[model samples]
Every structure is written in C-alpha cells, then in structure tokens.
Target: MPKQIEDQKKILLRVRKISGQVQAIERALIEQKNCDAILQQICAARGAMNGLMHELLEVHLKDTLVVNQSSEQERSEELQNISKILKSYLK
Candidate 1:
C-alpha cells in the first residue's frame, strides 16, 4: 500500500496525459490534418505510451521486488522474471 501510494499521483498524471494525446489524435483525424503531421503525432503518442510503460515497470520493480527482497536467491529469481517480462513487453 505504501509503495503504491508513492507513485500514484505521478502515474495518474501520466494516464491523463496519455488520454489527452489520444484525444488529440482523434481531433487530428477529424480535421484531416496533413499526412506527415498526423503520422508524427501518432509517433509521439506511441512514445508517450512507452514512457508510461517504463514508469509502471519501475514502480513494480521497486515496490514488489526491491522493497520486499528477502534473500539473494529470491532476488535473482525475481530479477530473471522481470527481465523476461520486459523482453516480452518490448517485443
């Protein structure tokens, strides 16, 4: 609970920003914005989403594994699992 509360504000802010970006894309589509500009906006939105993902991963890693680490073996296993998750997520 403490771990979650730490980043809740920042995380919610990011979600709101992502929502705005999505809406902007919708508006651009309706206005028939230039092809290149629309593509750039889409790319920007993708970047924002990726940033949100990174923030989420950082929070999870710190709150779940780093904070609760009990032993070297557990730490190693959790790190491996997190690494695999990141690889799959990026893919």
Candidate 2:
C-alpha cells in the first residue's frame, strides 16, 4: 500500500468517523433536517479536513524539509516558504 494509505490506517478511526458524519449529513439533508444542524455538520467536516491537512503538512515538513536542510540559510529559506504557504492557505 502507499505510504499515505499506510499512515491513514493508523488514524483510520478518525477517518471512518468523519465519513460516517458526512453520510449522516447527507441523510439529514434528504430528511429535511434543521438548516442550522446541517450547517453545523458541514462546519465540523471542514474542521476535520483541515486537521488532516495540517497533520500531513507537519509530517512532510519534518520528514522531508528538516532532513534536507544542510545549512542555516537553506533552513531559513524553507521556513520563509512555509510561512508563505500558510498565509496563502489561510487566505
């Protein structure tokens, strides 16, 4: 299996729960559930996706960038790039 899938297995429970929550949200919509409640679920799912992205980005920064940085200048440049990425992503 790919490394991402392998890594996901370790966190399978959270992923599974997120999937279930999405399914529930879909059902709620079909059943004409409260708009506020459906929106709350949508917000929760968005937060969950963001959490997953942050985890993957953290691993990439540590395992790839940290390993390859051989000089203070290189490391500083990487940090600057990462900061820029974060700013763009947040925007």
Candidate 3:
C-alpha cells in the first residue's frame, strides 16, 4: 500500500482525466458533432467516471476498514479477496 499522499495523487489524476473527458463531451455538444460520435464520447466519459469511482472506492475500503481492522492473516486474505472482486467488477 502507498502512503496517503501517493494515493491522493493517483486519485487526483484519475479525477483530472475524468474532468477532461467531460469537457470533451461538452465540446462535442457545442460543435454539434454527429449523434453517434457524441454518444461514443459520452460512453468514453462514463467509462472514465467509472474508473475514477473504482479507484476512490478501493482507497476508501483500504483506509476505512482494511487498514486497522486486524493484523491477522484472515484480515489480509479478506482484503485480497475483496480486491479481486473489485477488479472483476470493473471488468
């Protein structure tokens, strides 16, 4: 796991990317791009937003529950399993 500062940096980068995606969508709208093209851009923006959500959720889980819940093997295993589930979910 990384320090909170590192996690924050990563999270912020994702957020920035998501913002850019949204701005692109707005620009497309203003330019009156084709419907299909606009929809594709919307999908891309949605995917970026989902990715951001995924990153933020993982950080929240690690910081809020996994970090100090326990030092036992069971806790570690639980974290790993949850991580796997999350990865599968995003896919």
Top candidate (lDDT) = 1
* Backbone steric clashes in candidate 2, count: 0
| Per-residue accuracy of model 3 over 1-91 as CA lDDT, tens digit each | 4349989999888888888888988998999889899899889888887887778777877875667566678677777878897788769
Cα RMSD for candidates in order: 2.3, 3.7, 5.0
User: What TM-score, over all chains together, does every model reach?
Assistant: 0.79, 0.62, 0.69
The full ranking of all candidates by lDDT, starting with the best, is 1, 3, 2
What is the lDDT for 43 in model 3? 91
Better of 1 and 3 by TM-score: 1
How many pairs of residues collide in each model?
0, 0, 0
lDDT of 1 by residue, 3-63 (tens): 7775988888888998998898899999999989889888988998899888988887788
Model 1 stretches astray by more than 4 angstroms:
69-77
Query: What ranges in model 3 sit over 4 Å off?
Result: 1-3, 69-91
Residue by residue across 1-91, what tens digits does model 2's lDDT show?
1145656574565578789889989999999999999999999988887877687677657655665646888778878988898999899
Better of 1 and 3 by lDDT: 1
Instruction: Report lDDT per candidate.
Output: 0.84, 0.76, 0.81
